[model samples]
Target: MDANFAFLRLPDPRLYRRSNLTFSLLFLIKFGVKSFKFNTRLKMQEKLVAAKYEISRAVKADLAAITRIYNASVLEQNATATLRPVSIEEREAWFDAHEAANRPIYVLREICDANLTSEDGETFEADCERKFDSKGANLGAQKPSVTNPKGEILAWGSLSDYHPREGYRITAKISVYVAPEARGKGLGGRLVNFILENAPKFGVKNIVALIFSSNAASLNLFAKFGFARWGELPEVCDMGGKIESLTILGKKLG
Candidate 1:
């Protein structure tokens, strides 16, 4: 991905929380039951969904690009609450902190022109390349270790620190971002599903996602993963423009 694509605006945390919620859900019993169903096997399919995007850990080499993408999210006034842009130095610090704590940073990349199959007749990614050439698919050939060929990364999702308490160690805050070009492709759904399925390996018992009240895409993504609202702040942030509300969405892991 080219970091030079300045058109991709980052999240403006303050403005987002204050924006009127495009949609609202009352704290009703029916709503609760429907939400709970996703966590149970009774409605597991509804809990996890995805587009054709690929998910993988962020390699050290991916830091520059990862930083670029994240910063893009930061620039969007609606995506985050923070008014300041994230810096690479801070990202490196985050890397060090996660490494020391054994946490992980994930990256979703569009598979490059890549052939990713063991089949010899033709390249796997090459076939995919022909199929989605217009869409600019990342054939998954760049990372030979990650099997299964696919088109380029349309979006990515992640698990951030949950909280600062010991009991809460089994929890994580999740975030998903799809390239603006890749929205509506189900990539966010796919990334969230992959993360939820693997949450337990990291000892996660709860999955949390902090979103601006106006962020419909993120809210829907969490809902797709069976996450429900646990807390709400009427207006926790004050961006230069206005104040915004915050909603915390969470799901029990096991």
Candidate 2:
């Protein structure tokens, strides 16, 4: 495979927890056999369900979805600096810049399971009303079973070369974008962690993040991982006539 485009997104850990709990409770209630004995089996099954989505190297085929995900962020005016939607053709060179070892792009996708059913003893339909638990957990019983189920990239992260100079090769910039519906559920954190663990393998000694100063969530997310302020660029972006600043953060890998 062309290694440059093979890095794909991994599943959000938060979804795994939700999937585990849903499967466990449903199986217990459906079979009417409640006991601790099923805990192991439930866990095993949960892993299988969670495995539907995976993290791997991005591939040439994923550029469209990646573009859409990035465009979504751009239109929202919170994450990326781009102000207009970009076409896949425009991003081709950008995608080409990523290599497996030095710079890589990863995506997260949901693999549909056709036979999956919901907890309410009913099958999921395209137009069916979704059921939720008292705590607002989605109790819908179907895994995405559409054609090219994995085509829908839920989130993505990347390691970008920080500077063109050879002296800056050891440092890289990090970025993570989660689908709007999937935000605030720990998916972004999971992607950041994924890149952190793999970045050193690519010879990265320091990871930097440039975030909008007004984005509290992104700021806190990086801070949680020990990334501290390195510098700032004042009034760098005009977000709808409002001047916004950018915060630079860095985390050195030991």
Best by lDDT: 2
lDDT per residue (tens digit) for residues 1-254 in model 1: 57768679988987766553432334365677655543343222222122133578765655565566666676777777657777777778877877666566666765543323322222222222223336665322233344423333445566767777777788888877665545676767777888888878888888888888988878877887788999988888776777779988989977
Candidate 1 deviant stretches above 4 angstroms: 1-53, 113-154
Model 1 accuracy (lDDT, Cα): 0.64
Report lDDT (CA) for all predictions.
0.64, 0.76
TM-score of every prediction relative to native: 0.64, 0.68
Candidate 2: residue 251 Cα off by (Å)? 0.2
Model 2, global lDDT = 0.76
Tens digits of per-residue lDDT, candidate 2, 1-254, equal 67855787788999999999999989978777434334544444454334455566787778887887788899989888888899999888888878633599998764434443434444432321234568874432234445344534667899998998888989999999876655655767778888999998888999999999999999999999999999999999998786889999999999
Residue-pair clashes per candidate: 33, 15
10, model 1: CA deviation in Å?
Answer: 82
Candidate 2, superposed: residue stretches over 4 Å from native: 1-52, 113-151
* Location of the lowest summed lDDT over 10 successive residues in candidate 1: 42-51
Instruction: Identify the leading candidate in terms of TM-score.
Output: 2
